[model samples]
Target chain A: MTELLARLPETTAAHLGLSLAALTLGVAVAVPLGVMAARQPRLAGPLVGVASVLQTIPGLALLAFMVPVLAALGLTSIGVLPALLGLFLYSLLPVLRNTITGLAGVDPAVREAALGVGMTPRESLVQAELPLALPVILAGIRISATWTVGTATLATPVGAPSLGSYIFGGLQTRNYAAVLVGCAASAVLALMIDGLLRALALGLERRRRRVTTASLAGLLGLGAIGASPAVCTLGTRDEAPIVIGAKTFSESQILAQVLAGRITEQTGDAVRTVDSLGSTVVFDALEHGQIDAYVDYSGTLWTTVLGRGEPRPGRTELLDEVGRALAEERGVHVVAALGFENTWVLAMPRAQAERLSVRRLGDLAPHAPRLRMGGDYEIFQRAEWAALVTAYDLRFAEQRTLDPSLMYEAVRSGQVDLVAGLSTDGRLAALDLVVLEDDRAVMPPYDAVILASERLRRERPDVIAAMRRLAGTIDDATMRELNRRVTEAGESPAAAAAWFLGRPLPP
Target chain B: MIRLIDVTRRFGDRLAVDRVSLDVAEGESLVLIGGSGSGKTTTCKMINRLVEPSAGRVLVDGQDVAHQSGPRLRRRIGYVFQRLGLFPHMTVAENIGVTPRLLGWDADRVRVRVRELLELVELDADAVAERRPDSLSGGQAQRVAVARALAAAPPVLLMDEPFGALDPLTRERLQGSFERIRRELRLTVVFVTHDMIEAMRLGDRIAVMSDGRLVQVGTARQLYEAPVDATVRELFAAPRRQARLIESRLERGAP
Candidate 1:
């Protein structure tokens, strides 16, 4: 809580900048396009139709899709640029639709009057038509202002810092306070901005110089602040903070925080985190130099990246081979192999496991046909699942794919008798689940290792050295405890990491 | 002086003004009178190039209206519409000053002319100059529209049912004020209306139109006394007959 309060100013700037810049750009582009569309009715439908389609896309998908689209266009693929582009696209519909509708709604009689009074088409539009349409257009701007504030939070997953950072991090770690703070702050910011827009409309309508000037000044001030490069660049600093990335999961978030905390403590260099990335996006980001480092499991690198179909070797042999392959193939460096594995494990409620006397996969085979199984959505789709089913010759009565965050609760409530779970999930301990042995070793070793891009290894040896110190420090128990502090006790990952390192929290 | 030399206007396939030709002597008030869609408004618009003729030409002061750009020609000719189009966003002063400002008159001159026009239209310059259209009554807005049209002191004026939306009392008062302004300024005017009484009261010569064609052009007394056809006589009497019919029907229903 204290950490969040202390960092409030930076968070507020990021949240405001991304959202406000998007809206400013949206209005700038859309208003002129809307005027053209209004003048040329033939083009209005296609222009508005495209914006409508953009608005219909899911917010997170729209933001994430910008990564590759921008890369192809030779633009920045991550952080504030892509986030702003996504937001600007989303903000178009309301303003564009309203401008068209407002222009159309002006009295035809009044238009004839303007023409009769010798107003050029241009003069009529500027002096009479737009002013009459002001109220409606202003309403549209108000809708967009509030909407962008809330949607800006989703930018975090795309490596942009926003208030959504707090909410997404808190949701993963199950911290309700941080989530509440994020939601409240954004809502309040939206209301304040919306009120200012309303004042602008009133000023225009009533011709009140003071109200109009103040309102315009306020909006321009926000736009100016948002336009400045310092506010618009997410997770960037003058000293160029070492950016750490994490995937969209609780353990990944905690590990990223641990790395950032450790790096900042040891070197006194600034560290910025761009967490909540997509599963494979972190690797892609690192390859493209969008991020400096992140942790990855060897099994993920082996199957997803390398496309190897052979049975896995021992953990030590697998790590060396994977490390060598990554270096040769993608120019990524295996900075250190954190000495803990997070392989897949089949788990069930302890009472249920005891009742069925299922201590191993072979033991569970007889009871499989009578049991309903549950697992994270990806686990059901992975090669490990197919291998285990084939080796054990097991079949469940039903199998459900659920979010990993809810898998423990689903098993605890007997919604499913079994779940494929991660070996190091804090929920496994907190929820008192028993792990069944994988005697056939169908699942591959997944040693959590810190990986860096080749650029980071060659150019910033000091950072790699600091990162290398964490290689063997976090064993299974220590990793489990660190995860527990976040997932069970609702402690922030930075605090847990700080405590583990016996150092003060990084500013 | 304005001359419509066989001017014809078409909106798609329908001819709004078909082969209509007329002349307004300098300082003459020529009222084009007809029922709705009779092309009176279209003919009035043609004088100022608001509606360009599909065939033939309209000449203003010996120059073809088409020779000048639409905006340039319109700036020299005053026009008033039925809806007033008073520019609700601007103050009465701003609305009156629009044409003069467009003409590039000095700001000081424009301010003085705006005040003069406001008073010329019988509105108090101090009380009404800063007020917007919405704050004014319909009659006041109509007057401001006239003042705006007259701002550049254009020699020729085109008005299409300028007082059509006002109440009868306000309409009559505005018509009297317009009559005085016309005589005082010695302006050449072409007024369009469906109202027979307004044409008789204000026009120096009335041109009666029917079915996009002018049926007669003469003084109001001459047209009222002589019958061009059943349509022209019916046009003049249609109002009184309709009113009597409605009154009789209402009295019968009351019993």
Candidate 2:
């Protein structure tokens, strides 16, 4: 929890920076467009329609969509740019709608008085209409601010460091304290912003100069404090730190910290970890040089990256094939296999397995007709699931998809008879679940391998050499123990990684 | 100082004002009296170009209004709306100083001018100058509107029922003060109102309008002696009947 609190300053700053920048951009674009729409009856409908439509696209998908959009434009797809752009787009609707509505709601008599009093149309808008409409516009800005702050948490998956890091990482590791910190901090930030803006609106409406100035000062001061960390980091460092990527799970997070520790120790280079990335996003980020390196499974590379199906090769041959294909096709270099396979395994509660006499995958076929199964959301959609079904001809009475974290509890509580679980998940032992053997040897190898971007290998061969020392060091038992320390014991991934490296955890 | 030559205004297919020709000499007051939709307001607005003439031309100080931008022309002509139209967001002083400020007057000059105008309208400058329009009573707001119109000291003033929303007593008090201000300033005025009594009291020459055309233009006695039509006679009939009722009540010693 202390470690999580220590991370708050940086993550909160990044979250604030992204949200404020987006809102500022939103105001810049939306206000003028709203004014134009309010004046032009023909334009009002289409202008608001476009913004309303943009808002309807789910926020996370909108953020993810910017990755490809920016990449196509030859701009950086990951990190702050794409996340900021996505948030800016999301903020447009509220501000634009309010601007039009506020202006439209102005008394026609007041508007006429503006013009009648010798103000040009521009002067009327600037001096009279806008000022009168300010309270409503400020209300819209407040809404946009809170919404932007909350949605910014989703920016973590796109490699933008935000308070979302705590929530996503904490959820994967069952560290609710970190998640609570993230949620509470962002909620407080949103409320603080909303309150300041509300005060500003009231001051403007009531024409109280002192209240207006104070609230304005508070808002600007908050923005500057939030933006200071980003501003200070600019142009200060001689070299960019090596970025280590991690997917949204305990094993990936642990392996990432391990790799980060090893590379920093051996190369004496600064390193930063971008954690809680989606599985495919991490790989794509590595390929595009958005990250330096991450740990990936050989089977994931073989099936998802190589786009192969049906044929299952030998374990060693599959590793070589995946490594060669990635290097040739996508410029992602497979450095070394980290001697543990976090493969997909069918597991059942020990007592249930014993009662059903389901000791192997083949043994499950007879009892499968009466049994219900559960797995993580992606398991049923994965290529391995197809291979298993084809090999065993296994059909369950009912199938349910669960989050990987919740799957163990679901099976333990008898919500489902069986679950396709990860081989190295600590909960397997904690919950006393038995793994059903793949007697036919149909499941492909999922050896954990270190993957590096072409840019990293070309620029720093020493980092690669350091990472190679990790190969064959961690076996199945050691990897499972690391996972258990994180998921069950509530230890952080960094601390578990530190334990594995035989170093005292950082204070 | 203000002239409307065959000024015609149409909103889409509906003719709001048709061939309305009128002129106010320097330092003269002309009231345009009509029922609602009778184009008295439209004729008044055409002088300031708030509503442009669909045909013909409006002139102020011998220059065609169409030659100048609407705002530039308006800056030289004072206008007060029927709704009083005080800016709710601005203080009374700010509302009054709008025209002078827009005309590029310095802060000190505009501030001095705002106080003088507020005093000219019989309002306490110190007490009301910093207060917002919403804080004012109906009579005070009406006075502020009048003060705002006279702030820039334009040669021509167009008032569209400036005290229309005020109660009877407040309207009468504002009308009396406005009459004194008009004569004191010797301002050329074009006033629109539906009340025949207000027209008789305020207008040097009353122009009665009906159905988008001028029915008669004359002094109250001249119109009373020679009615152009039933509409013109009916406008005078309401005031005459009210006077008769009040005179008979006083004769009977009623309160």
Candidate 3:
């Protein structure tokens, strides 16, 4: 709870910046287009059809899709730009639809009156029809304002910071307090925005000066709050700080902090972190130079990227093979191994394991049919899961994909007999779970390696060299302790990384 | 003066106004009397270029209406619709002041004109100027609509059933007010109405239309005494008989 409060200012800024920017831009564009659509009957169907189609895309997928699409356009694929664009697209539908509806809904007699009063079409729209339709259009804006706030939370997974950081980070670390804080803040923000818009709508409807003044004042105050962070970010665009990314996990976040801290310390260069990226997104962003560097597990890249199902004889051999493959094929240079392995592992509660006498993966086959296995959403789709299932000949009665945060609790509470656990997860030790050994070596070494974009390698070799100072610096216990600080002690990854590096905390 | 030369307006395949030709003299109140769909409203609209004629020309003051921009031509001609389409979002004063302001009148001058029009329409300017249309009575709203149409003091006016939506008592009162105002302003007006009684009461000359063509154009007494056809005679027959019966009763000193 304290951690969430401490981080409130930055996250609140991000949440407001991205959501409000998108909304304002959305209205600016959609309203005029809507008016044009209303005027031009020939274009009305296509205009509305396109906006409706955009609305049908799921919010998360929409944000995710922006990363690569922006990259393809040779633009920044991470940070607030892509997020803003995605939310803008999402915010467009209601405003456009409502503008069209409200304008169309104006009484024909009233329109005649406008024309009869000698108002040009433009003047009629500006002075009479728009004012009359203000309430309805504002109602649409209010809907979009609330929706944008909620959808902005999904921006975190696309390398944009928002209130979703608390939710995504807290969920990954099993810290529900942070999630509650984020959800509550977003709901309050949404309500505040909606209330102001409602006031503006009422003012327009009744043409009351006092109501208009109060609502405009309220909206202006929020506008300042929302615009502040965005202004700051855009002002720094010329500097273009190196963007470091992390996937949605405590270790990933901690590793990103370590890299950022090291680069700042050694090279004295400006660095920015865009954390909570999805696994594939971070890699794609790096390749496109939207992000300069991020830490990835070798086994994950080998299987997911290379489509190689075969496991090598040893950890070093696998690492060497994958590292060479990445550099040769994709222009991604492996800076160094961070000397920690966070591989996938199967685990059960100690009591359940003892009761079933399950000491290894082979020993679980007999009981697998009666058991329900739980894992994170990606586990079922991974090659590691397939390899493990084939090696052990194991099939649970049901395989449920739970969030990473809930898997431990599910296994601990006897809701599930088994789970796919991360090797370095703090909860694996905290919950007294027994990890089954893989005798067949079906899973390859999952050494965490720092990978840099080819552009970064070519342009900033000094930064890479500085980052290599941390090669073999963190061992298994050290990595686990860092994770524990974030997941259990409520320490932010920045603070944990600073503590581990014996340096002052970031301002 | 306004003239429709072979003016024909078609909405799709249906001819709303078919080859109608008429010349309205200066300061003449030409009431277009017709049943529903009789093209009276279409003819009125053509004067302001609200609806362009498909096959002919509308001339205002010896100039082609199409030569001037639609909005510019409309600003020179006042238009009042049946429903009294006063802008609900604006106050009565603002509604009345709209065209004068559009003509670039200063605030003080626009305010004075709004007050003058309000009085001309028999409305209390002080009481109703700040009130919105929704707050006004139907008769009051119709008055404001007239005031709005008269704001810029256009020489030409086009009214389509301006008092059609009012109660009989209110309608008669408003008609009397309009008659006095029309005479005072010496305005050239093409007033459209379906009611023969209204046409007789308000029009200097009434142009009656049936279907999409002009049936007869004459004064009330002229049309009453000399019937163009039975339809035109039938239109005024009942009212003429009622008036004569009432006159006979008065002459005999009967209550």
Candidate 4:
């Protein structure tokens, strides 16, 4: 709990920075566009239509889409940039629509009176039309602000640190307290921002200068404080920080911390981790030099990166081919294999497996017609699952996609008869589940290998050397124990990683 | 001070005002009396270039109105709308000072002018200057609107039924106040209204319009005694008939 609280300041600052920057930019772009549209009826339809279309896209998909869209434009594709762009786009519809509506709703007589009183078109707008429309425009901004704060929680998956990091990391590790804290904090932040803006609108409507000044100050002051961390870092840092990437699971998070610890110890370089990234996003980020290093499995590279579907190679051959293909074609360096294979394994409750006599993949074929199966979100979509189905001719009565953390509990509690789980997942032993043997050797090797970007290898070879020291350091038993400490004993990934390195916890 | 020579206006295919010509001398009050769509309002608007002429020319102070920008030309001409279009967002003082401020008068000058105009319109400067238009009664709001028009002290004033929205008592009171201000300032006035009695009461000369054309322009007595057409005669008949009805009622009550 104390550790989670310690992370609160940094995460809250990141969340505020992303939301406020996006909202400020959103207002800068949207207000003028809205005014132009309000004047030119021909433009009003298309401008508002485009913003409305953007609003229809689901928020998470919008953030994820920025990754590739920005990459194609040769811009920053990960971290805060993509997240900020996505949030800015989301904030446009409300502000733009309200600006147009508010101006259109102004009394025509009042408008004519402005001209009658010798006001120029420009003066009429700035002095009369805008002042009258202010309350409505402020209402739109309030809606946009609250929505931006709430949606910023989704930025974690795109490699931006936010309050969402707590939710994503906590859910994967079964730390409910962290999730509760993230949810409650974000709700409070949204409410406070909303309340302050409402006060500003009321002040403007009632023409209270003191109330307006105070509320406006409160709003900008909060934004500045939230954005200060990012500003300070940009001002002070002389060299770019080395960014480590991690997938959205406890094991990957631990491995990333392990890499971060080793690099910092040996090279004394500034290290930052962008965690909770999707599998494909992490690989694409590394390929584009958005991240310096991450841990990936050999089987993922062979199937997903190499696009190989047939003729599974020997374990050693598979690792060598993956390394060669990555280095030659993608300019990625294979730093080291961590000497543990966390491959896909079919698991069932021990008592259930014993009762059903399902000792091997081949043995499951007869019972598959009656049993229900479950797997993590990605397993049912992978090539290895297809290979197993064809090799064993297995057809389950029902198959469910579950979170990686929850699948063990699902099978143990009899919600599923079988689950395709990682071999090194500590829950396999902790819950007394038996692994069904791949008697035909249909599955490919999944040796954990460290991969570094081409830029990192060239520019920071010492950092790469520091990472190479981790070669064959963590065997299957040791890796399983590290996972056990997080999944069962409720330890954080950083604590488990520190234990492995034989060092005290950081801070 | 104001001249419209063969001035015409068209809203797309519809001719709102056609080839109407008139002139107002300096310090003269000319009232335009006509029913709805009779082009009286459109003719008045052309003097300030609020509605551009589709044909012919409009001249103010012997200079063609089109020669200057609309805002610059409008700054030199005072106008009051039929609806008394006071800016709801501005205080009474701000609304009155709008024209002077737009004419680039300094802050102290605008402030002094606002107070003087408020006094000229018989409004309490301290009580009403800081209040918004929404807070004022019908008579007070109408006074503020007139004060706003007279702020920059333009030579020409165009009023389009300025008291049409007020109750009869309020309208009468405002009309009296306006006549006093107009004479005191010697403003060249072109007032538009549908009320024949009001035209007779306030206008030095009344111009009657029908179907976007000026049918007659003369003093009230000249038009009443020698009307050119049935439209001008019918405009005069309403007031004459009302006078007879009231006279008969007074005679029967004499006992």
Best by lDDT: 4
Q: Model 1, range A289-365, lDDT digits (tens) per residue?
A: 78899999998888887777576788889889999999999889899988899988998889988998889998988
User: Which docking band does candidate 3 fall into?
Assistant: medium
Clashing pairs in 4: none
What is each predicted model's overall lDDT from 0 to 1?
A: 0.86, 0.89, 0.89, 0.91
Which digits, one per residue and each the tens of the lDDT, describe model 2 over residues A1-507?
888888798888888888899999999999999999999978989999999988999888899888878877877778888889999999999999999999999999999999998898999999989988888888899999999999999999888888898888877877777889999989988998899899998887876899999999998988897788787667544454698999888899999999999988888888888887777778778877888999999998888778886676899999988888899999999999999999999999999888888899999888888999998867898888988988899999998998677777788889899999899999999999999999998888899999999998998899999998888888899999999999999999999999999843233
Interface RMSD for model 1 amounts to 1.1
TM-scores of chain A across the candidates, in order, are 0.89, 0.93, 0.91, 0.93
**Distance from true location, Cα of B140 in model 4, Å:** 0.8
Each model's TM-score, in the order given?
0.90, 0.94, 0.93, 0.94
Docking class of 4: medium
Model 3 clashing residue pairs (backbone): none
Q: What is the lDDT of residue A295 in candidate 2?
A: 97
Candidate 2, B1-255: lDDT as tens digits: 777888898999999898988889999999999999999998888888888899998888899989999998888889989998899988999999999999899999999999889889998988999998888898998889988888888988999998888889988988999999999999999999999889989999999998899888999999989998889899988888999999999999997
Error of 1 at A276 (Å): 2.4
